[model samples]
Target: MSSTPESKPSALNPDNKKAPVTNSMPEHISLDKWADTGYEWAGEVEPSSFQRLATVLSTDHEQTKTQLDANLYRRNNVLHLAFTLTGNVWLTCQRCLQPVAIDLSDDYDIALLENESQVRLVNEEQDYLLLDEIITEQSPERLLPFKKLVEDEILLKTPMAPKHDDCEMTVEQFGEIPEEEESENPFAALASLKGKL
Candidate 1:
């Protein structure tokens, strides 16, 4: 919670006993006293808390890559996080329904609420969280939905599958459908009764 530079990370030593940072983009960052320092997203996350690595692969297809212009600051008891994420991603193609390469970039400005159970509900009229400087007895209960944002950004930028102008599957692959069989009209039997009326 102190603003001293020593409290900030400078460079990550793999041998250092701390969280394993997954990304290499912030290599010069130093984690002095955070647990499992590398991969863990807990504690006072500083700009240098991350590594200088380019990619942080959380899964086979899901990752956080590129430079992070992010910082964690606390004014009073409230925390504020601001950052921008830009990177290339692989997402499902919208057209062919296949994996497609995509470019993603997103900017975020989040006010960290201090309460353990702050209401996540937001006003529909405003685009920002309308809460004041709330004192939190615990770590923030809510954070900007990061994964969802990345997924949405990727989905928005994804191209239709088989993005090439000409796909391999040709028109011939679509076979023609047979015509429908004709059936006798049910009204035909009622024609005789109409004449009698």
Candidate 2:
């Protein structure tokens, strides 16, 4: 494929690891173009920038940022992506209902395919993603929402039920389990009236 004028030397060079991250990195891009051109991008986005994540956050993160690095290239005519997401976030502790700080770090090397028919392109060492599942909002098989993709990775890393290893709150403090008290049954009065009748 012929290179576009906007494609820079660093973007053209798939092995250029030292290339600096730029503000020109787009939140979304054409998956076809990125793989065809061997595009690479790196950036840090605030955790608060994530719409779904922001609502679940329990701590004040005015300064925290999630680091994201993505590299897309074609090998043997199959597109591959090397992606990383690392950052710290705070979630509500299920035990005490307080903020519990968590550190997230993950790395993924995945094969991108348009459908299940292309699954043979991937080997055992790599994971794979079907465009049919992820590219719903955009074009059928072209556009990729990179920002949401990274956010999804972070969400996967988050604990399902987050709680501190050592909770400071006592049993009474956490939430008191109501004690069952012995009481008269609701049907007792009816039973007595029925006997009298």
Q: TM-scores of all models?
A: 0.38, 0.69
TM-score of 2: 0.69
Q: The CA-based lDDT of model 2 is what?
A: 0.70
What's the C-alpha lDDT at position 104 in model 2?
74
- Which lDDT tens digits does candidate 1 get at residues 102-168? 5545765555454534334332331233233322123334223333322333344444442433434
Q: Write the per-residue lDDT of candidate 2 for residues 105-194, one digit (tens) a residue.
A: 778777878678777777877778887787777455577776677677778878888889998764556677799999999998898899
Every model's Cα RMSD, please?
Answer: 11.8, 8.9
TM-score of 1: 0.38
Residue runs of model 1 more than 4 Å from their true location after superposition: 1-23, 26-67, 100-103, 112-178
| lDDT score at residue 136, model 2, on the 0-100 scale | 73
